[model samples]
Target: MSNLNLSFACWDYDRIQALTNGTVQAKGIDLNWLNMPVEETFWRMMRHQEFDISELSLSSYLIAKDRGYPNFTAIPVFMSRFFRHSGIYINKHSGIEEAVDLKGKRVGIPEYQLTACLWIRGILHHDYGVHPSEMNWYTGGQEAPGRVEKIKLTLPPDINIQPINDEQTLNQMLESGDIDALIAPRAPSCFLNGSPHVQRLFPDYVSVEKDYYERTGIFPIMHVVAIKDEILEEHPWVATNLYQAFVEAKQKVYDGFNQTAALKVTLPWFVSEWENTRQLMGEDFWPYGLEKNRKTLEAAVTYSYNQGMIKNRLNMEDLFAQSTLEAYTL
Candidate 1:
């Protein structure tokens, strides 16, 4: 029989470049890679289930699963992970000199349920004693107006979330001192443009993030690979196959980084940076698989539950395909 054909939508990342470029292929399947911006992929997938497999927001996926609305299941292939400390932008005039100062402040977010914002909120609450209920929240597009949450939310009474006016964007609000700070995966335009009004909450976020990882071992996960439930029901083996393929593709990236004849990446100090990262985080720094990421995953679930994003605190095993929970040893 011919191999199964499926559409997989995700952003083009170096780790998965092999699969996108046909250097790696999933066994028993022919993937039709759809290279799309993460925001578009997430919106379309969450709203319409438009692809066979897609990169999904971890926070939004949990919300959907909790609501029992989407027929989707995930594998352990985390497509995007980041340290969210750098994403927290603040107005210089907002009097928010530290994370603790965020209490009682007005904070803007691209969306209430964004994975990046979820991690930021969780870290702030857990580490800095700043609860979500302590501050007011405004949600809208970071650079454009009219952006809204992909899935509707009915948060608890304590969480104060509101939408900005259709005519206003979070970037403008932050620059004009209309909002105190912004938490998002992407930097606001004003901060990028070096507007005197905007700055990162943690100016030395690199050091802060490293310290966080050393202490907590939680390198926040932002996106996961999700497959349609219908496909899983039809081809149960697809999960393991896809998971293995993603692992192989990621290994290719690791192998490329080991080459020192000439820098595989464009960074002038790529070798030193790679060595420093390996020394800090170990050989497989950007790790895949459920077992390798359990602590981080558990933290995310706990955050989701405490923040009222999910009705129940889901068990870590329930979040991934059962087949993906283990791998065969050679």
Candidate 2:
């Protein structure tokens, strides 16, 4: 039988290099890998369902499914995860020395519904009693102007969110102290360029993030791999095949980290860092399947519902393909 050809759009990550470079192949499928920046891929896929499969925002996917958009369904493969503490930037003159000071402050975000911001808000609310409704929100592009939410949202009345002027960007707003803080996946250029005005809310974010993980066991998932519903309806087996391929691709990266003869990554302390991570997070640190990630998944669902991104708290199982929920044991 001929292999099925499908278009897949995602960012280039070391974990998925095998699949993108054709070293790992999905069973009965041929991937036309479309490597692109995450923002473009997300905008095209969310607005138009442009790809057969793509990496999707976890919060956006939940919102779409809850609203019955019917364009996509996801497998349990998480394409991106990060600790968002480092993403929160604050202006020096804002008088915001801590997370609680964000209450009643003017905070900027690239979008209210971004998965990273969702996690940030949830973490602040839960860990420090700073609720989403406490602050006034400005939304626009981080570096460019006129950016808008990819998915439509009907947030509760208490959450005050507004778009910045079309001519302005969040990075500029944050740098000039027009907004007291910005929460985003990427650090603003102001912070990257070492502007005296911009700084991370948690400057020692590595230590803070480590403490957070030790306390809560959540590594905050940002993105999931989704297949168009049309493709899934036609070939249900595609879900399992793609899921297995992703697992294999990820494992290859994991194995590469152990090659001590020569460093697999460029860092001088790559092996030591890898060992420290394993000591802290265990062997299968970046796991793909559902059961291994239930706590984090459930937390994300809760955050989405509490922040009004979704109408109800979705069951964790409802977020992924049934076929990808289990694996064959040897």
Candidate 3:
């Protein structure tokens, strides 16, 4: 088997450390991964289709599907149970204790894309009964001008957004009570949990989130992996080999913390949200089980579709090769 290049997302060190391992080296699989920003990764993929396989965001996947990209399917890997995608951060001194407290308050965010802001607002309005736009919303951040002619053609026009220039200034603004809430994705972010200015607004993570989404058709995206259909048709062995390698690597990292020596290697990689990694999965979470992954993926697709980000419903079959999980050891 030839070396496979995996284009992946910016997961703050924890997930990165888990997936890059000896199993991948032993398999002769080279993960030539490009570390790009969360949103740009998809834009780059759409433009060049450079990587052999990679993780994709749903917005990117929808754009790809609409553009007639072939043979791409999402194999469910991780189930992000928390409000993992879009976080609501309030000033630590603001006395904001819950998600509902942000009502009629000003908020600052980096970008206003289809997936991130849209779903956040949909949940706020449909589920929580708070209108996000009515809140004094600020969308700031400089976008790298689109260079690819074709990709630019496919994307919607920019929405007058200018991302805040400096993290310090944003921090100061939050400290000064200029922005009531800070909304953005994690990693390279001033987010709720990690940001000193903000505290976790909600106590019950999973229950509150599930309740919100069940009432409103909005759910946060964890992450997704996709392979080009052309590559699968041309090289069938790639699926089994790569999937097994990832499965092994994922388990190896998970199992490492249980051992004293391996804990030395893995302790630094544990992010706050990922401290529950071992607890996140039950005793039977390893071996790439299809049942749990399938349930998570189907739920995600249903929510994204219902919210109109997916344009139409996508099934497990449309998005993945179901039998491929069988190829991967549980």
Candidate 4:
């Protein structure tokens, strides 16, 4: 039988380097790997089904699945995981000294349904006394003009979300103090450019993130690997094949962390950092399968549902291919 040829679109992260460099091969398949910006890749795949497999935003994927878009099915491969507390930026003059101070203020977001924003909101509401209904939300592009939410949202009646004018970006509003705060995956240009007025809501974000993770056991999933529904239906074996390849590809990156003879990484404390991270997050810090990530996945599903991104509370099992749910141990 001829190997199935497929196009796979994703960011060229170090962990997935093996897949892009052709060192890791998907079993019984020939992959055309395309390295591109995540937004372009997601837009092309969601709007036109441009690739047979692609990395998709977790929140957008849930919204798409709930709305019956019928384009893709996700796998347990979480390509991006992040702690979003540090993503919340506040105006120093807004009088918001803490997360609780965010109440009754106007906040800006790139989109209401962005996975990073969802996690931020969830943390704010759950950990602190602040609720989504307590503040007004403004949505638009962060640094660029005219970005829109890819999926429609059905926010709670008490919640308020307004879109900014096409002429203005969230960065301008944040810097000018038009918005009290902003929650976005990428820092707005004002903060990145060293504006004294722009600062993280949680100045001690590292400690806060560590405390939150220790309490909740969630590393917050940002993106998942999705396969075209049509391709998946016709070629069921492709799911497991791709999953295994991704696992091996990520393993190659993990193995490089311990290479200390000549310093595998440029950082002087690369090995020390790795050891400290392992101590804090465990040996398999960035696990990819269903079993290891069930708690985090469940929290994300709950957050998505609570935030009105999904019509139904979905079980994590229903989101991924059944064949890839469990590993075949040796």
Local error of candidate 1 at residue 256 (angstroms): 0.4
TM-score of each prediction: 0.98, 0.98, 0.65, 0.97
**lDDT of each residue in 1-330, candidate 1, tens digit only:** 899999999998998898888899999999998998999999999999999999999999988878777889999888999999999999999999999999999999989999998999999998899999999999988888999989888888998889999999999999999999999999887888889989999999999999999999888899999999999999999999999999999999999999999999988999999999999999988888888898999898899889888999888788888888866222
Superposed by TM-score, candidate 2 places the C-alpha of residue 218 at a distance from the truth, in angstroms, of: 0.7
The local distance difference test score of each candidate is 0.91, 0.92, 0.53, 0.89
lDDT of 4 at 194: 98
Q: For candidate 4, lDDT tens digit of each residue in 1-330?
A: 889999989998888888888899888999888889988887787777889899999988888877878479988899899999999999999999998999999999988888899899899989997888899999998888899877666788999889999899999999999999999999898998999899999889989999998998889999999998898899999999989998999899888887778777878989988998899999999998888898998888898888777879987788888889855322
Comparing 1 and 3 on TM-score, the stronger one: 1
After superposition, candidate 1 runs with Cα above 4 Å error: 328-330
By lDDT rank, best first, the candidates go 2, 1, 4, 3
- TM-score, structure 1 vs. true: 0.98
Ten-residue stretch with the least lDDT total in model 1: 321-330
